[model samples]
Structures are given as structure tokens and as C-alpha cells.
Target: MLNKNLQNTKFDIRFFILCSIFFVVTSPFASCSAPPKLKTQTLTITRFDKSTITLVAEIAKTEEEKEYGFMNRKDIPDGTGMLFVYKKDIHLSFWMKNTPLPLSIAYIDSKGIIRELYDMTPYSLAPIIGQYACRYALEVPQGWFSANNITVNSKIDLSSL
Candidate 1:
């Protein structure tokens, strides 16, 4: 019984140490922070083909908006979506947790050029990580990008708003 107790104690110590190490290593970099202030607004998106489509988007500019995201939402109105803005470029990561509507996300670079597009599954915890660094993310209804001819290199005219 004494040996069993010692083994358990050692395991607990090791577990605690591992957790501490992980925290120390990742503390400086914000993995996931508070949600940002989201606002319902509008923006014009210019496709690679020179066609433009305007959308009523909820701009996620604060930490609170980013965290809450589209969670618990049943639908995104037609011609409207959500846009996440970052101070600088980052490898954008997104997931659908408690979000019932399927979405397509576009990673936009600092120049407002669309760098990547990915379809996301509804209510999925699996992360959709961007392969390139970007300063903004736009989330719209699934197939919205393709249907509207929005593709890589498309511009999301971020200069105005």
C-alpha cells in the first residue's frame, strides 16, 4: 500500500510539473483571449473578377466579440456576415462551437487581399487554421465565397471600414 501511494504521489508531481511548464511556455503569447466588441456594419467586397458584393457584417473589433463569435446563432441573414480584425497579421484560426450555421472564412492580408478561403462545419470544435499570415478574417454563409465568385486575391476594401 505504501509503494502504491508513493507511485501516485510521483505521478501527481509529474503531472503538475508538466502543466506548469506548459503555462510558462505559452504565457507570453495570447493563444485565445477575451472577446472583442462586435458591431453590425457594412462593407464592400471586390472579387477577383472585379465584381463587387456588399455585405452587412458584424465587425468583431474587441476581445469580447472575437470570443463569443457566432456561437448560439441560428442563422446569418442573407448578404451579411462577420468580420474579425486584428491589429497586425496573424495565422488566423477559427472553429464553430455552438454556431449552428455553416460558414466560409476568408483570410485577408494587411493589404486587404484575400489570401485563403476555407469552409467550416457547423458546431465543430476542429480548428480551421490559415496557412498564411493575415490581418483580418471574414466569415460568411457557406458557399457564399464561391457563389459570389470571391476567391483568393479578392479585395475586401478595408481602407474605409
Candidate 2:
């Protein structure tokens, strides 16, 4: 009877250990809290006059990221641009609804050429429309394009990404 009782206690201990192990392994996934996002790469772009600008871009690979792109970002670091990627080529327009940072947006073509550029004010909520349909739009600090002489018909190199 003592041997049987010892065997039962061992089984109970083993069961408890297995439960603890399962919780340790799977608790992270079961938690509803979202993990912090990770950045993959830093992008470097050039102006029409050959001035270089280094930007840490947030990749808009998903629909949600594209939709909520830079909406609440109050300050964008100088010499950096936010790169927005779309699944397909379409007419893209951005408004400063929730954005509180002054920005200059560049509409890029499929060949990574700047099709249009616009300087936008912070917290305006006014629609900053693109002149032509583009596959991507890059947001930089206000007057960055003009200051660097980056304009329409200028090519943007994405080889660094």
C-alpha cells in the first residue's frame, strides 16, 4: 500500500510539472497584450542634386500599417523619411488628420522615381493630394525635398532597403 501511495504521489508531481511546463511555453501566445514591433532596416535616399538623406522607414507591408501610416507620430527625426508600400499601383492621397509633424511627401513611381512632391503642415487635416498615381509614398520632414533639390522626375534609390 505504501508503494502504491508513493507511485500516486510521483504521478501527481509529474502531472504538476507538465502543467507548469505547458504554461511556461504557451503563456506568451495566450496573452492578449501585443508585443513591441521590430524594425528591419534603415533606408538611404538621394536628392536630385545628389545630396544623400538617411531615413529610418517604417515598412507598410500590411493593410493596417498602410492605413494607419504615421498618423500619430508627432516628430520625425531629421534626414529621415517614412516609406509607405502599397500592394498595387493606385492613386494615393494622404491627409494630416492625426499627424502632428510637418512633412514633405513624395509620390514615387514603379521605377522608384519621384512623380510629385508636396509640403504638408502639421495637424492641418487638409488633404494633400498626389498629382499622379504611385506605388509608394515617402514622407520626409518639411522642406526636405526642396532643400535638397529633390523634385519630380528625380529617381529615388531603394537599393539600401
Candidate 3:
């Protein structure tokens, strides 16, 4: 009986440890893909008409940061956005899973020129894929591009990033 009780105690401890690990791994981001706010920098957009607009950008340099994106974010103030960076120009894709904010994404070439612009619906499961090779993607509140007169071929000053 004493040996059986010892084995049962060991099993209980192991089960408790496994459950604790599971909670720790999944608890922080368990609610609606909520992610911690990332680092921010000043980014400037030079429009095709030669006018310039400056905004603050949250830099998403890591894969995890890029994946979480603005998920569960309810409010995106005007003049602020997120910048997703890559090592080289490639086909860029995005989805609005668990993201409630309607956004406009500008796919930018390695030279910092806007290649394409796409408007994304909130919580949309459809993938918004880019045909052009792009090194970066900038997401802002919907209609921000047209509102600011920033259109395709506009130069984004990546050097300031």
C-alpha cells in the first residue's frame, strides 16, 4: 500500500506540472489574439503629388509580431499605423482574423515605392494577397491612403525607419 501511494503522488505531481505548463503557454494571448503593443517609430509618406505626411508606425520586425498584427484591436487612431518588414521583396499576404479595425494596406517595393493598395474588411477570413513583390506592408485606418492623397507609386521614406 505504501509503494502504491508513492506512485500515485508522483503521478499527481506530474499531472499538476503539465497542467501548469499548458496554462502558462496559452493564457497570455488566449483572448481574441490580443498581443502586446510593439515598438514604434516615426514614418513619413511622400505622396505621388510631392506632398508629404508623417505618422507614427508600430514596427513588426519579428514573425510573431507580424502574425499577431492588430488582432483584437478595436481602435486605431488616425495618423498611426503598423509597419511589417521583411528581409527581401516577396509576395505579401494578410488577413483580418480577429482584427476588428477596417484597414488599408499598402504593399511597398524594396525601393520604398508603393506597389499596390488594398482595403481590408474587419474580421475577414479571406486572404488579401499581393501580386507584386513587396518588401514591406503598411496598415492604416481605412481610406487613409486616399484621404492623405497617398497613392500607388508614392515613395515611402524607409530610411527614416
What RMSD does model 2 have?
Answer: 9.2
For model 3, what is the error of residue 138's alpha carbon versus the real structure, in angstroms, after optimal superposition?
A: 0.3
Better of 1 and 3 by lDDT: 3
Tens digit per residue, CA lDDT, model 1, 1-161 = 99999999999999999999999989965534544546677788887668788898888887878878887777787799898999999999999987889999999999989999999999899999999999999999999889888899988888866
Give the winner by lDDT: 3
**Local distance difference test, candidate 2:** 0.75
Residue 77 error for model 2, in Å? Answer: 0.9
Flag regions of model 2 displaced more than 4 Å.
1-40, 50-52, 159-161
Reference-based lDDT, each prediction = 0.87, 0.75, 0.92
Q: Each candidate: RMSD to true structure?
A: 8.7, 9.2, 4.2
Q: What is the TM-score of each candidate against the true structure?
A: 0.75, 0.67, 0.80
In candidate 1, where is summed lDDT lowest over 10 consecutive residues? 28-37
Clashing pairs in 1: 34-63, 35-63, 35-64, 35-65, 36-62, 36-63, 36-64, 36-65, 36-66, 37-62
Note the clash tally of each candidate.
10, 0, 0
lDDT of 3 by residue, 55-156 (tens): 899999999999989998879999999999999889999999888889999999988999999999999999999999899999999999999999999998
Per-residue lDDT value at 131 in model 3: 94
